[model samples]
Target: MPHLSLSDLTFTWPDGDPAFEGLDAVFGPGRTGLVGRNGAGKSTLLRLIAGDLTPDRGSVTVHGRLAYLRQDLTLDPNRTVDGVLGIDNQRKALHRIESGEGTEQDFADATGHWDVEERAVATLDRLGLAHVAPTPDALGRTVGTLSGGETMLLGLTAALLGDPEVLLLDEPTNNLDLSAKARLYAAVDQFPGIVVVVSHDRALLDRMDTIAELRRGELRMFGGNFAHYRETVEAEQEAGRAAVRDARADVRRQGRELVEAQTKIDRRLRYGKRMVAENRYPKIVGNERKSQAQASAGKLRGNHADKLDEARRTLTEAEELVRDDREIRIDLPDSVVHPGQQVVEVADLTLACGPTVSLAVTGPERIALVGRNGIGKTTLLRALTDMPPRVPWRALPQRLDVFDETRTLAQNLADAAPHATAEQIRGRLARFLFRGNDSDVLTSALSGGERLRAALAMILLAEPAPRLLMLDEPTNNLDLPSLQHLTEALAQFRGALIVASHDLPFLREIGATRWLELTDDGVREVDPR
Candidate 1:
């Protein structure tokens, strides 16, 4: 049976435009892909279904227990990882073990009721954090000390604890490593509950049973994977185009006939006037013949006029079809420097901040930059991209890292090169999806994926396009199709791509020739094969 139903739903933000109205959807026990463009309300839908918010109209009904992994991290920082997971069962057992004040029935209820500890340990192990024990260790640690990526993983694990009938996961793999993404995929595949995931991960979408896309202000469901959904949408577009073309042809044909009939009627009327003006009493032949021709012409003209009007109306409808079916364009800038061969040359480069932190990346390579969290992957990218010194030291000149979250994308780039004028900066920003006021908005307001795109777009706009494209987590918040499109475009680009991402399938699909692996101490190149 289906686990959830959304019937005739309508919702909007306070003081903001309406998001969706008259929307109806149903989801059952299976992995479902939820996809949409930026600001299309994917997050809103998830929150509504999770019961965090109420819809202005319609109903959202859940038939069974539901668990949701929110985009924002929510966990008890004071508790240990195991303490968080073992909350329900461990408390019962520990209560019985700690206080001996209970009868046989109470002891049984507390002791053998549930194997909470075992379940907690298993869940932690599944999350690749099995080393964490239920009790405190030498390192005084709680969930608070864990990295954002680790916290996200643990929250997901906790959400998956009781095996509820439904699960709502929002970008669960956005902050994970390649191995962690695989773990998430495995967990979702084996889960018996209904799953609704809002993610931009293309590799993950390939595993779904259905694709639900929110566009403009409407939601559409397609029965298949991401690729299938696209194909179906395109097919519908083609059908709409065919209808428009047929309508146009009918209009043109009828219009020409109407013009020819009107000309014949005018000529016949003039001939009749000339005969009457001659005053030759040729009334019988001229009048009768003129009347017959006029009647014939009038009938033909009326028929053609009717067809013309009908055609005009059809043309108007066809135009509506054209406007409705056209796809929105994201206007990417053309690249400048087309290098012949060697784009970036990196030697035995070792980057380090302190004694406990260091990373390395060898040059003349197509490397996948990878690590767990709080590691120096992004730092290494900053060094490569030659971004401003947030630290005390100066970045390398040759390297260019594309992670500009400091200011408005344009302002940051303009600051990077003060010699450039506002007009030049505006031109550069336009290509990167930052046009006009978009260039003025603070970087903090931009979405993760949009920030990455803006940064890369600036790189592509560079006079001599950076030979070495050092991207720090480029696929973070991008939708599946956008990521795939980017991957395909990057494949065509003849440059050294040094990307720091945890998306394994994304890395593999992009054909990373090598990998620069980072640890707490330093970095090394590894062959995943």
Candidate 2:
């Protein structure tokens, strides 16, 4: 079997923050999906496994050739398809030999290089890039015009061309459209060697043979796909929560017993003192009785204290097993709009991707704007929000431009909603779960979930509080928990919403009243369910 294993693997960042510590894991010959929270170090673990970063202490043992497809490798605008596929050098050498004017070394260099173009073309074709021909000109096609999904697929093709037996992919589906994701999943399903992918895409994870979760510096493996992994975790969490409740009750019981014991001891001591004062027995005999009572009291108190301490320790352990995923409780009281009120109306508006759209919104209508990647979905949203509207509106672009990284989250929200007093902003931040010192954390240091909450605050709490809110692919950058937070927040919005997203599950969760698909011709109503 083509085996990959890690023994006592450990890693830390330059700033002394540990990403992984004493991590040991093994992979059999199949696709394994890795999942975790935003800062749980899934990418770091992949890097460590791929040998891109050396472990602080331990070993990575691989039984076959390895290749890694990085999640965020930015392609140069000038780079060609052949370059992205990593066969530019080979193609160039082969071209030189094929040309009428060529040196003898060029022919020798082209020995193994001749088949590079063929393999590249076939791989790309297999990945649904049949548009990329096998010709030299097609190989020279630039990557600047390719969509984000196509670029990602191109990277995967390059990795495949290496004929690696062990492949590692980190967030391979980020920013990819539904079609691209489907193609990627198919490719993963067809891989002949062991593959490990770290991604938040549920559909992609479902195709995996196993799921591995890294959390709180520990890596755990589950024997099945993402759905199975989630089921197991959910059951375990339920049990853990019950354990915590039991432990807490035990602690309280022990506390009550300790207090009762103290009270009894105090009563006994008072009785002993009274007997001594009364001279119920001889002075020496009374003194001995008092000493014995004091000793017994001390022993009883120590016993109860020990029991309470043990109970507290058990409670702590139980609490650690249950994740504390705080939620965003959005309350937009000022944004409420009556059912008869008109929100926005547009007619025959041309989009950047050649589609003309026209739509009207009223009351608390929720609209889901969905389309393929590189289409005019985002552009249409920008155009709609930029036009003069009869009502107050706000837009949250996919890049989250609403935040200023230099300031704290509270400061950023304050800047966004300058008309509001500091107290108002603090209250809004609290509802988003950034309470007290949490709101004071720098925006740059905020996690993906925190940033989402801050972004919500920046737009929704702004001046002339928006009655119509527009968000562009909000779920693209969010983790699973953050996605849920966003859904929860959007659910509470009592205003018109125009959300552009490729996430179907999220759109459904938000209870979008209307589904609008931006086609090449124009926008049309479609039932995504």
Candidate 3:
């Protein structure tokens, strides 16, 4: 069985921010879901394990061969499918031998991989990429023409070809469509090696054998899949809350006891003074009795004070056990439309991808755009938002590149809604979980989830308050918490929404009123219910 281990691992970014410190964890022979907040170093940890980045200290050990699929793939546009798969050289060598131009060097280069093409085709087919593997010429097609989902599948196929014992995938489902996602899920299920995936896709995480959470520079492993992990965490949190309640009650009781003890001491002291004033006893005897009384009172006070301090400490410990997962609380009152107001109208619009879409949105309808990869979903979204409609609208594209990277998040929001005051923008940002100095952080430095949140803030805070909001794959790179926050925020939106995403669970959670599937012919309405 393949295994991966990190012993006392520590890492820090170029900016001197520590991502992980003294982290120790082990993964062996099962699918493990690596989860964390956007900046919690899930991706960084994957990079370190894949040898893309070196840890500042400690060691990373892999007991078998490893392959890693990165989140962001920067492939040359001119590279062919075969070239991207890293089998181009082998294929050329086989072709040379077949054409009677064989040389010793040719066989050496081929390395008995005469069936490499067949294996490549089979791998591509397994990944639902048979469309691009029909012929040799098809495999020669430039990568520039491939859809985002297809490119991702191609990357996966390339990784699969290696048949590594340890496989690492980071956000593998980011650009995939519904069908592609299913295929990827199947691949993951069938993989026999040790699979570690870092993703926000709940459906994918639900299939894992274990869930490893990286939080505050520590790795904690849960015994089962994401669903199991959620159940465990919820139970622990409930217990933690109960403990806090009891601790608080103890503190209050201790405080009251301390006050009562002080009151008793004061009464005793006053009585003793009166007795002395009356000369109730001989001088020496009275003095000795007074000293004893004072000592007893002091002891009682010290005991009460000690109990109170201990109670406070218990409360602090109890509070520390509870998780502080803050959610984004936002209400877009200005964005609400009238019950029957027309939000969007598309009349026989032809997209650049050859799809003709026509539709009308009224009131606060939530529409989900669904389809396979390269079926013009993103293209349709672009077409719908390209020209201004009757109502105010905003579109969040798949690429979250709407901000000026060098500027701070506050600056971007302010630029989007220039009429709004700095104080107002900051207030709105706080709702998005960007509090105080967080709002002043540069957009370039934000994590994937943080960038998405910042983009949403800018869009929702526009001057006119867009009544129609369009989002293209909004949940791609978000963490579980960020995804939950996004869902919560969208639930509060009273305007029309057209979100193109393959995350069916998220769509359902957001109360999508209608579902539309984009196709080569046009857009077809599907029953969401």
Candidate 4:
């Protein structure tokens, strides 16, 4: 069986930041989903397993052949299907052996190459790549004519042709069409070897036999799929939060007892002094009693201090187990529409891709534009912006390249608006939840979620205060927190919104009033529920 083991594995980047520290783990014969937030070293771990990056210390032991499929692949338009599957030389040697012109070396090479053609054909047929490989002569056809998704699947086929013991896939489903994604998922399901895939796609993760989470330089194994792992983590977080609350209460109680003890000691000391003055007892006896009281007070205070310290330590440990899941709160007062206000109007305008959507917005309306890749969603959004709508509009693309990273949030907003006063810009940023010192934060210093909010702020906080906003795949590269932040902001937007996205959960959360499904014949209304 194919397997992998890492013994005290450690890795650090060239920039001096540690990616993994003393990581020790073993992967056996099963499909494992490697999950974590962006920059949590999930991809880095995959690279380490694939031998792309050498470990800083320790060793990786492999029991069988390994194949790795990376995200950014280089394509050669002139390559044939046999070449793409990396079986050209072997297939050629087999051909030479069958033609009676085979040399001794060719005959030797053809020994293992006998079944290479059959195996390549079967793999291509399974992945829906046979259609692009030229039906009669699939292996002889050039792959330059293949689609993007076809190209990716062809690469996966090449990986599987070797029948390796371990296969590592990094974001294999990214940018794939629905049909391609389904085909890839099917391939993963039927694979018999150990498969480790790094992906943020929930649907893909849910197909795994086991989940391994890489968080904060620690590796954790969970049985079952992504849903099961999430349930376990949520339960752990609940218990951790309860522990934190209990520890805090204990600290408070200890503090109160310490103060009360001091007060009682002071009262007793004063009483002893009064008794000595009144000659109720000998002055020496009173003095001795006072000294004893002071000693007891000091010991009591020390004991309470120790208890407080222990409680604090307990609180810190509990906090480490609990993850922060705060969502953003948006309040854009400027986007409000009074009576008789005009919004964007889409007349029976048919798009170049043949999608005709006609709607008039007079209030805060939210529209969800969804379809498969290359369905003219972005083109439609760009068309809407050119309609010369009654209100100002801005569209946020997937890259979010609007903000100047070198400038602060406030400065960026000011640069966009230009006419807005400093106070105005800051107040607008506050609506996007960037209040107080957050205004001075550089765009480069913000998290993924904060950067998104900053982008939205700059758009909606324009000179005329845009009432029409368009967004394209806002949740593409966002982690969980960033996704939540985007949902929160969009849900509360007081303006019109037309968002094109494939995230069903996000669309449901925003409560989109109109769901437009772009189809072959323009767009059809669908219930996103």
Instruction: List where candidate 4 sits over 4 angstroms from the true fold.
Output: 72-125, 128-131, 134-154, 177-179, 325-367, 372-472, 494-500, 513-529
> Once model 3 is optimally superposed onto the true structure by TM-score, how far is the C-alpha of residue 439 displaced, in angstroms?
3.5
- The sequence of per-residue lDDT tens digits that candidate 4 reaches over residues 124-234 is 788766565534256877755454446668889999998887999877765455666888899898888899988767888999989999888889889999999999998
| Residues 29-49 of candidate 1: C-alpha lDDT, one tens digit per residue | 798999887556787888899
- Of 3 and 4, the candidate ahead on lDDT is 3
Total clashing residue pairs per candidate? Answer: 7, 0, 0, 1
lDDT of each: 0.68, 0.82, 0.87, 0.77
Of candidate 3, the 10-residue stretch with the lowest lDDT total is 325-334
RMSD for each of the candidates: 6.2, 3.7, 2.2, 5.6
Better of 1 and 2 by lDDT: 2
Clash count, predicted structure 1? 7
Candidate 3 residue-wise lDDT, 129-163, digit = tens:
88888766577777775667888899999999887
The local distance difference test score of model 2 is: 0.82
TM values, all candidates: 0.72, 0.85, 0.93, 0.75
Residue pairs in collision within model 4: 355-522
